[model samples]
Target: MKIPFSLPVIDDEVIAEMMDTLTRTGWLTTGPKVRALEKEIQIFIGSSNPVLCVNSWTSGAMLMLRWFGVGPGDEVIIPAYTYSATALCAMNMGASVVMVDVKDDFTMDPEKLATAVTEKTKVIIPVDIGGYPCDYDAIRQVLARPEIRKKFRAEHVRQQQLGRILLLADAAHSLGAFYKGRAIGTVADITVYSLHSVKNITTGEGGAIALNLPSPFDNDKELVFLRALGLNGQNKSAFEKNQPGAWRYDIIDQGLKVNMPDLCASVGLAQMRRYRDRFLPERKRIFQFYLNAFSRYEWAILPPCRNDDATESSYHLFLLRLRGFDETERDRAIQQISSCEVGVNVHYIPMAMLTLFRNRGYQISDYPMTYSLFANEISLPIYNNLTEKQLQIVVDTVVDAYYSIAGTEKTNVV
Candidate 1:
């Protein structure tokens, strides 16, 4: 049988919970299970109130933008090396995207990012791609610039500004990831985590947001209100209306339908139980195995676990790059590896390469480093259950595929 790219590891616990939710027959919305899952995530991240689940990472992304007050004519800075959803979230809110190039490491270079920030920049979404954390200190330093701060404040609010550009993180890749022992959750003003099936944990299809703003209301007050925003902006949620026939509610604001169902939340809660205790360490071991295999190969650049001594990735995706391979050779090697029964995939094509960015007149060639990195990148499977024999097959396939395409004799691992 051929190996798939990724799969959710579901135990009987998840199944049992799903059956329980069904048999109990009251949960069609965010209920006790969802609330419990939210608490679990909050305890894990140690964030203030306002942690909320959305239908997907994109929903969380847009919601964060909305909270930061990004709307028409506002521009949000985003890395070119990320999934389209990262930029699209800003675009969905009618915000123009200031696409910035990434370093060869596939992270936004903080220096380059600062240069892109202008008076119109409403937010900056730095992605922790391939599970490697971006340099938070560098990003924060850039956002702290006085002139930039004044311009953003004067232009956006025209009066009472938030004092700095919001560092909204697309930490969809980093869940357990740490920077200076601080988890990704509280690193930025707001960080959204993807609990998509392929992520470190699966909620079937879901995401969560964690806030790091100034807090006097850390009493889990914001979390209760946040649910109202997703479930029709009603003042009273279903559970709240369950009191002694006083089932009345009010529409406070016009919101969207993107809440996590108990069905999905049940899966997340189960995964959360295993994330720190089981899944992460297993993934770490697999990451170490890949590092050991690829370390001697000078052409192989390992993803950063920490940036200048301040980050630890979730080790979500192992992105391998070929040093001297051209585009055709890289694609051929991927094909060869697939033929060898290892399913390989590309991280992304720059947004500019697609019709949407092209229509906007954005040029991929202009972002030299972004194009260069994309040209050689291939995503290798790094999930928990990927076995030793499977890993050997993966390693051997990559080696043979490279040699088959390059037509070179077996060289040392380097």
Candidate 2:
């Protein structure tokens, strides 16, 4: 049987909650369920601010970029070791993406980001690639330089007449991850978390954005105003409209309809409730099992449990970086695993290596670290539903595949 990559660990709890939600007064777009989910996320993450539940993290990126006034002449720096959605959102907003290299650890390196900024740069949407949060405080230091500060301020004022350059975070893979003893949602000016099936927490197909915009950026009714912007600029939510005469509303801005519906939020709410009970513990246990099994292997370079003293991640995506391997060999290893009925996938190709950036004169050779990280990495299957037998299947398949691809005998296999 082919062991799939990550899949949602849905259970009867989710079914029961969803059933209960269905019996609630409303099933419309942004209703009680979404509010409950958002509240749960805020509490779980310890976020002081209420999170904005969006349809997807990609749309959250768009909403933040648009709110920050990113346009054709603007640029947003991003690490190349992430999914295309991190970059596509910038392009979708008519802003160019400046792809930077990643560190050996696969997270965005602050030093590399320092070199990527330019006069036209309006935002830096660094991704917490593979559920590993980047050094956000260090990145903030680079952006805080008087020269950078001046340029950022001037560019923002010139673009939207605002005074601050946005530090939007693509934290899609890090819903429950942490940095510096705090959650990922509170690290940057705006942090987006995905609730996709493959993420640590699943809402089936949903995401949330936590806003922490700087001063003169938002206060008073700004967050409330922004809430409306997230829901098609409509002044009143569906639940609010149920009240007499509250149906009369105004569209403050030309916003997109990217609100999270209660159906998806119901799943998220259940996932949140069972997170501490089932998902979190099982995920850690599974990771520990794999770590123990693979530690004896000569060619294995396991991913960081904690990037360093400053962070403690949710252990969502375990990036297995095989030693003594190149990109071609890595692909060969993946193929071998598939043949053995154990599916494997590469985290990314690096943004600069892709056609979209390559055609724009962004060279893969420029980001050597990003390329090197990509060349050796493989993502193993991880989910709560996987059993001990299934894990053994994965372990055996991977070892056998590694031996076959690296041209070593079964006796030499780890």
lDDT of each: 0.81, 0.80
Q: List the residue pairs that clash in candidate 2.
A: none
True-structure RMSD for candidate 2: 2.2
lDDT string, candidate 1, 1-414, tens digits: 477778887889888777778788567567788778877888887765457777799988887676556888888999988999998999999999998998877889888888898878888899999888888888988888886666675344411345567788898889999988788888887789998998998788999988766543342555566667677777776766876886988887676667888889888888898788889999988888888888877667666665556668899998888878888999999988888677889888889899999999899987899888888888888887889888877877887887788787777566
What 10-residue stretch in candidate 1 is worst by lDDT?
153-162
CA-only RMSD, every prediction: 2.1, 2.2
Compose the digit string of candidate 2's lDDT tens values, residues 49-139: 7688888888888887877767798888888788889989899999888888778778788888887788888888887776778888888
Off by over 4 Å in 2: 155-164, 216-220, 307-310, 410-414
Worst 10 residues of 2 by lDDT: 153-162
TM-score between candidate 1 and the true structure = 0.94
**Candidate number of the best lDDT:** 1
Q: Give candidate 1 regions above 4 Å deviation.
A: 48-50, 154-161, 215-221, 307-310
